[model samples]
Target: METIFGLDLPTWWFLVVGGVFTGYAILDGFDLGAGALHLFFKKEESRRIALNAIGPVWDGNEVWLVIGGGALFAGFPVVYATVFSAFYELFMLFLVLLIFRAISIEFRSKEPMAWWRQLWDVSYSVSSIMLALSLGLVLGNIIQGLPIDDQFIYRGTVGDFFNPFSILMAITTLSLFMMHGAIYLVMKTENRLYAKLTVLVKNTTIFFVLMFALSTVYTLLYLPHMVERFKEVPMMFFFPVLTILAVANITRQITKRKYRFAFFSSAFVTAMLMALVAVGLFPNIVLSTIDPQFHIDIHNGSSTDKSLKIMLTFAVIGVPLVGLYTGFVFWTFRGKVKLDETSY
Candidate 1:
């Protein structure tokens, strides 16, 4: 048990993996949110403006996902293998939808025909919605505990992943993303589109608040285990409290027409929510519903201490470089999106 700042190596790696995925969710979430709201912008110019709003950086945002996945595989191979195997079909579908979503962004403006653009618009919106929902479903199922046996093998069917709790989580994820995206769009547009998006931002905010409230009530009633950590360690309660404040500030900033602040608030809300998940599932990467003995935790699920030590060195150097690059890209593309002949 090599210690780093009072915590074990595996715990540090868990934090690393969680931080990377949280970055992915916050960065990529807005684009997916924008895509999910694509069809709502009916007019060609409005849709194109929306598409261009995310065009310069959507692909770059996915780099965090790749990093997160790699970190997961490196740090927690057992949890990776078990979860991926358990949700093989769902992951495959998620992959296909990801491909379609990427292609829709690239190919939507290739032709002048209404039918062609309309086809890709539907594909884009549907793929974005499903992608967000699928992520939520996976998170919900993971938090709720999986049916894993003693060997760390999942024994549940694919159908088991579609339970009511998971569905509620999926909807909540979608709504949150939608609200996040609308805020980003509002920040990146002006005039009529900006005004329209302000209205949308409010609506999406309401939608997310409703879904979040329902999810909160459902979890408190049915998944009481989630709150046990906060109860045991009262300090951990700050994350949820900060999350509520961030959610509240989203509306406050939006109402004040400070969309940049609103967008940052949304991103903070995203980070805090993920932090809540990490806090709730600390130590245990995957919980087994069948038996506590089957639970895969940081210690059992992680690689050798030496491996983590070596990879941690690389991560220290590499992750900051990725962050710098991401920051540079966003800085370069700062301000309103203007449609041009070369725009997508």
Candidate 2:
């Protein structure tokens, strides 16, 4: 791979993939979060409003996931191949839930029957929560290190993915998404539903903070190597500082009833957290629990420089266009949701 200012093309591709994933978390996160909180809205109108809140852009937001996955595969086929082979069942489950979530929204309002709506509502919320948990579980396992051999094959059973720290992270991810969704709902609702979401935002914020704190403590106490870079470079402290500031801004904006600012802060928090993860796991695409030398990183895992360069060209052009489309969708639907015959 070509090098730019000491960093190779593979490393640059890694950053691009990470950035794309961060975009996914920030965009689709509120979509999942809103679904996760579906049961909280008991009234029929409240649920519809919540569903419609994400109706315009949910599918578009998921494009980032596709792009991120593609970038990973194109840039580092080894990581993609190894991860997919290892997490086949988990990914299958994710796909099932993903389908359920979509239908739950479209089918919910199709029939006026109570049981029918109830079924879809439950499906939507449960599927959303499961999706969030799955993402967190994958992240936790990646951070904790995986049981991969020198041949880049996973040795551990699927059951081993659910360690204590990973489980906690799954919960933390759920809480974070809940908080993000609540903040979004607060922006897209009014009257009783808006008022209810106001309270939810506060509580979810607290929940996320508590969970994040506990996860941090666990990582610090048990997974010392995770923070090795932080200790080695005093300047790496900025990421944590940025996270704290962004979280504090979330609270500040929420307290002031500035939904837009609060929403941006929530996005910022996601970006900062994901950035830290990327920085912490730099070079190493997947950490090896069995042996350090078995670790999969950019150099050993990446495609040829020719392929990376071509993909980089596509990415450079594609990312901004997607961003523009997303921004345009948000701009089009930039207000509290009102139920019309057209609304889902």
lDDT tens digits, residues 197-234, model 2?
99999999999999989998998899877788887888
Top candidate, metric TM-score: 1
Query: What lDDT is reached at residue 244 by model 1?
Result: 96
Clashing pairs in 2: none
TM-score, candidate number 2 = 0.98
Native-structure RMSD, model 1: 0.7
lDDT of 1 at 94: 94
Consecutive 10-residue window with the lowest summed lDDT within model 2: 1-10
Model 2 misplaced regions, further than 4 Å: none
- Top model by lDDT, which number? 1
Clashing pairs in 1: none
